[model samples]
Structures are given as C-alpha cells and as structure tokens.
Target: MLTALRLLACRRAPRLPDIAPVGHVVGCLSPTLLTSLASGHAWAGRLPSSCRVRVPLGDLQCVVYSVYAPLQPSTLSSTSTGPADFDGRAFLNFGTSAQLGFLTSEPPQQPSVRDHAGIDCFPFFSPDRYVLLAASLNGGNVLAEFRPNSGRLARAANRTAVSVRDCLAAVATKPASASDPDPLISPTLLDERCGGGTQGGSVLGLRMSSCRSLGRLYRSVCLGLINNLLSLCPPAALRQAGIDRIILAGSALRRNAVLRRAAALRFDECQFQSIVLEDGGARQQPAVADGAAGLAAQFLDWVAAGRGES
Candidate 1:
C-alpha cells in the first residue's frame, strides 16, 4: 500500500489551482506495470513503497511525482521532494519532483547503468541473475539464461575470466579501475586496448584512462557475448537462471574445444568424470571430452539446485 498517498491539499483553495502537483490525484494502475517499474529498481530486493515524493511549496507542500522517462541506472540516488542543488539533505528529498514526474508520466524509459549512480545492480535484478556470457573459441557462446521468476544464476564464465584478469593485473601492478579506490585501468586490459603498447605505455594516454577503457572493453565483451547467446539459444527457458540440460546433451567437448576451455578453468575446483576424446574415448588422459561431460554434470547440478530439485 502507498503509505504516503494523499490527494493534493490546495493552499489557496480546493478549487483546483491551475498549477497543482500530480499527487493531487493518481488513480489506480495495474500492479503488474507497477511491479515491473518498481521491481526493476532492486538489486534483488523490493521497490519503494511510495511512488510519490512530497515537495513543500511555501506552506503548501507540493506533492511532487517523477517521470524519469528513461531512468538510467546511474540516476536514482537522490529525491525530488525538497529544494534543488546541494541542499545538504539527501538527493531524494529534493527530488520528490522527479518521483512525481516519474509516477505521473506515461511509462518512463528503462534506467541505464549510470542512472543508478555507479550502482547498476539496482533498478535491475541481482547481479547473479545476469550470466557472464562469452563466445567460445569456436563459434558457439557459453551462457546460462536467467529466469526473472526464479533463483539466482551462476556468474558467467566470461565474467569470471575478466574478473580473474582484473585480479591478476591488480596483484601485478595494482592499477586503478571502475571498481578501485584510486581506480585506474589495470596494465593488462589497457595493454590490449592500446594495441600492444603495454610495456612502454605509449599506446595508452595514461594509466587511468587505460584502466577505464579496459572496464568499458570488458562491458563491451560481456554485452556482445550476451547478444550472441540470445540469438543462438533456443526460445523456451532461454532467459532462465541456468543452462538447460539439452545444451549439454550433445556438447561433449573435443580436444581444445570450447567446452574444454570453460571446464579447464574450473578443473582445480571441481572433479570430472573422464572420457578421453583423443584416446579412442578411453580415460588414458584427461581430454576436452572429459571436461565437457563434467561441465554438463555440474551445470545440471546447478539447475537442479535452482529448482530445489537437488
């Protein structure tokens, strides 16, 4: 229920002033639409209970609403209900008007990453729900679909690689980045962007910019991989939190295959049931086929856990 919901209290008169705030009247809206808008704000949590912010207008508090027609993931850190510009009060108090504007308008736009003020997770689902998808050395993409209606999905293997790269670079050079305090680009990610000027630092303008560029490159890679997955995967259960069993059904990894690469990364952490693709399907040596089968079983385990069927 809207706790602060109330009709406009006209100071001059109830005769309906020409410039009355929006909350003077907000009729019913389908909860489905509301849920979509509101639920879109949590990083795996609930939406704000009150859609409208109350703005004071010289003894006449204006019931301001918001209409961020395209509420970017970078924008919603403050409020619209109070004065503008560094009021020392939190942003939302002054942003009641933004809220009012958002609520009264006809379906605002989806929030972008920056709109959430460097916190892209909000106004979106749990970060875990977004799989870290990536293209295989082959043409196929490795991915886990997300179900908005279900549990969290595993982080994309690609994300893991990028993260690992970032971590290693941090340890090696401790460069700044989007996620760092003295945030600068890591030496490695920047080197790739600079076209191999990594050692002399000539290709890169500076360490900071290069680090930022690497973050952007990582995002670009992640997004591109996601697009590929959406195009390649089957329609049903494509958006769920994990891979369908069928993806593994025919995915026995060949030597130096895509599946093997993903599995090789995780081999130290997980055990595999060996099936050597090179040794006439014998377990003479660990092969890509072994990794694929093992990966398949692990993916199945994840799906089962997601469904509480394990």
Candidate 2:
C-alpha cells in the first residue's frame, strides 16, 4: 500500500523495487478503515456507538455509513453456528461493492466490534452538476441564460464571467417553497454506470416559470438525491446499529450550504449529531489519504521501538 501511494504521489510508471534495508512493510487496508482512523475516534472496543458517514464524490459518488458494533447472533444464520461461526472475513453483501460488516484485523473468539457499511454508485447530485445537465438537455447555457449581462459586467469589474459557483450561491440563499416539486429532477443523470435499471432520469413538474428557476430546480434535485441516499441506508438501520454520531465528509457537503442544510434537516428526526469535518475554517484534506499516512508513521514508530522485529 505504501508503494502504491508513492507511485500515485510521483505520478510515474511502476518500477521494480530496489533491494534495500527495510524494517517493516504495511499491507493494503480498506479505505473505510483508513477513514475511521483519520477521524481520530477509536472504535475497537471503545466508543462503539459512533458512525462514520463518508460521502466521497469522484468519477462515481458513494455514501458509506459505518459503525463499530458486535455481530448479532441472528446475523450469522447462514453458518448455523450463529456468531461463533463468524470468521472476520465475512461481509454483509449489498451488491457490487456495497457491503455492511465487521472489519477487524483478526477474527475475535466471539462477535466483536468492526467498521464499515459501504454503498457505491450513490450520486452526490450537487446543484451545479444538475444545472449543467439541465442546460445540456435544453441545448442552452444555463449560466449565460441566468446572467445575460455577466460577461460585460465581469469585464468592467475585472473578474471572471458567470459560473456554476454563482448558481450554487443563488440556490443556497433562496428558501425552498413548501410546495416545491418532488422528483422534478433525477440525479441518475450524473452517472451512467448506476445499476438496478435506473439509467434514465426524470424532469417532472417543470413549468414556464420554473423552467429556468435555479432555486426550485436545486431544491427538487437535492430532495431526489437525499431521498435516494436514505432509501439505501435508512435512518432506522442506523438507529438499530446504535449509531449516535454521524460524521459527514465530502466536497459536496462542504461547499454547498444548501445541500448541507438539507441533509441535516432530513437526518434531524433521527436525533444523530452531524459533524462536518473541517480544519481551521477550511476544508480538511482527504480522510483516507491522511489515515494512510498516519498508519505509515505508526509502522515506523513500531519498528523503532523494536516491535517490528517480532
């Protein structure tokens, strides 16, 4: 894993490692495990009620809700020996990379606490992305349409022209109407690889007045995205898992205030405290990468302490 990290950092072709004096080697670990460590919240037998909610937006968007909890006896029905049969290698399969299970370094003699529950292909569905897609569908530049004089004014003001950032700001300030449209926009349009027969997207409730209304469009799209996420990992399931705290991470939640507000409101009823990871009033570095680096440091420390000799 360290070698892979080095290659990625250098952005160079992989080459054979030269023979050198190395004290220890670290194996590849799950990103979820690294993220848990990044939070600096220990969960292996301590603070088992906390949950890590990772919403990472890359080529594909995914939301992972992980907790450290013991495996219930009923969860091991397949083996017939109940929790005793758990082998630490077991994962609660949720189709193509979406899984919920105990993540441990070694199989415990009995059912014990473990880390993750991942849901892949879950769209982040940010307002800017949605507007861009909507513009493409209509064959017009939404930003240009919204700000007809932005180009000329920007030149006078010595600044750049209208952008998606402006659109997101508009959405954030404008209050969502009580009678706002539902499912007016489909988030599946953002990613073509989303499975389960949800390839096509919808744009229902569009009207002459709202056809260009960024706020209304944003609200509708945000609701669709949040609803889809909840269906995959419902609040009820989190409650059942004894999850008390939810750590929200992702560029989508951090940049867009409206999206963050909407997510908090949706999960408000669950009574789980939502924490958005930040550093000195700015977005923090990626948790997984930070965690990986932390592990590498710890490994070096272990070697220095003579623990690696074993």
What is the alpha-carbon lDDT for the whole of candidate 2?
0.40
TM-score for all models, in order of appearance: 0.17, 0.47
- Which residue runs does candidate 2 get wrong by more than 4 Å? 1-161, 179-184, 190-195, 203-209, 280-282
lDDT of 1 by residue, 1-310 (tens): 3433433333334675355332232334455666766664653235344433221122111111111111121121122222222111111111101100011111122332113221111111111111111112212221111111011111242333234334323333432244433221222222222132434211223345435443333223323332222222222222221221111112223221323333332221222221222335542332234333333343345446563112
Error of 1 at 69 (Å): 49
Worst 10 residues of 2 by lDDT: 127-136
Among the numbered candidates, top lDDT falls to 2
Residue range 82-146, candidate 2, lDDT tens digits: 22322322221111112222222223222212121222212212211110000012111222243
- What value of lDDT does candidate 1 attain over all alpha carbons? 0.25
